[model samples]
Target: MLYYAPDNASLCVRLALLALEIPFETALVDRSCNAQNGPAYTALNPNGLIPTLITPDGPIYETGAILLWAADQKPSHVFPAVGNPARAAGLAWLFWLSNTLHPTLRMTFYPTKYIDAGSAPLLLTATRANLLGHFAHLEAHADWLDDTQVSISHCYLAPMLRWSALYGTDQSWFDLGKFPRLLAFAKRFEVTHVADQARLAEGLGGTIFSAPTPPCPPEGSAT
Candidate 1:
């Protein structure tokens, strides 16, 4: 089972699972009532995070770790094989996404978690500038970005782009169109079979990545 909350980081793992054709069950972690902090859910994930993928060996937490584990389970094109030369580059960008990009977005979305409310605007300004630089770096040099194939990196990144557009307090700073390559990517990715399934399951509206809106999910809330 994959424990998830609608529109949460779990959405990344969901996309990977669907693309890989992995059969798994989902148990919603109702964020509205703080269900993730409850005993039952915390038993599976000590961090009390949204996604906790139960496997026969054990349970897996962390979005990137879950995506890696899922890809390793079967032969899939999503991630390069261990011996492949591309594996090194792939692993680098994957960790960069997990370590650098994802946390930057987190800080942007929840600035108060890092500093006082009075200083959040300052933090957002800095992070938004940082985000523009990050996207520019990827837009120019991340050769791993494939317009035709959905990789594990794409699974991690596309939702982040959506959140960047939709979640922050003052979202006016972001403009997906500025990154033309990424803009085209969002246009293509949102139409894929895997993305379509996620949209329906989470009640995510059209152009989820390219032009996201406040989600109207059927189950748990996005927060």
Candidate 2:
């Protein structure tokens, strides 16, 4: 399998592949690198995004799609192909992350794309409020998202929370004290061997966001 990803959005999938101990080649692409928009990359994904997977079948985009495919290929641990209700619950968080939370955070951090950056202070404020509200929501229902054993939801959420820290969003927004279970879940996920692989792939020596800001925080967080 060939994986094409930028440093940020691709980290979770990279970690998942590592967790499965699947050997695959990695291709790094980005705007600074100008690789994602190149014809060579575009040929793989017309959407011109990173985290495109080229398998024996073909190329696949979208993080959730790539993740489900990876899980299906492994099928036992990464996913439960037996149609277990737990599997459905895990998949629900994957879709929620992809469709809801991710898009909201994207807009919060990329308001300049839709509005003038100079006059978009209210947009940023609104974005921050919405993001905090969503984080609070996640904190409230942390238990349902976890199992006696870890599931795919753990893999999907870590990267999103990491992105939140990268944007200078207060970790308090996650209500770590109130969401002790989620905090424990995150801690366990971080120390895994797969997370190590992702860090190495992303050229980080330790955790995904050990510093105040992550290398990538959407497009406008730093502006």
Task: Give the top-scoring candidate (lDDT).
Answer: 1
What do the candidate models score in CA lDDT, each in turn? 0.90, 0.65
**Residue lDDT tens for model 2, 1-223:** 5444434566667777777777888665656656778998889888876678887789988878888888888777776675676676666667887888877877755678668968677776777778777767777765654554445556667777666665533344434444565566666766777776666556544555322234442321112
Model 1 / residue 131 / CA error / Å: 1.2
Model 2 CA lDDT for position 200: 55
Query: Lowest-scoring 10 consecutive residues by lDDT in candidate 1?
Result: 141-150
Deviation from truth (RMSD, Å), model 1? 1.1
lDDT of 2 at 184: 64
lDDT for 96 (candidate 1): 92
lDDT value for model 1: 0.90
Candidate 1, residue 143: Cα displacement in angstroms equals 1.8
lDDT per residue (tens digit) for residues 117-205 in model 1: 99998998999999989999889988766548888899999999999899978889889999988988888899999999999999999
Taking the candidates one at a time, how many backbone clashes does each contain?
Answer: 0, 0
Scored by TM-score, the top model is: 1
lDDT value for model 2: 0.65
**If scored against the real structure, what TM-score would every candidate get?**
0.96, 0.82
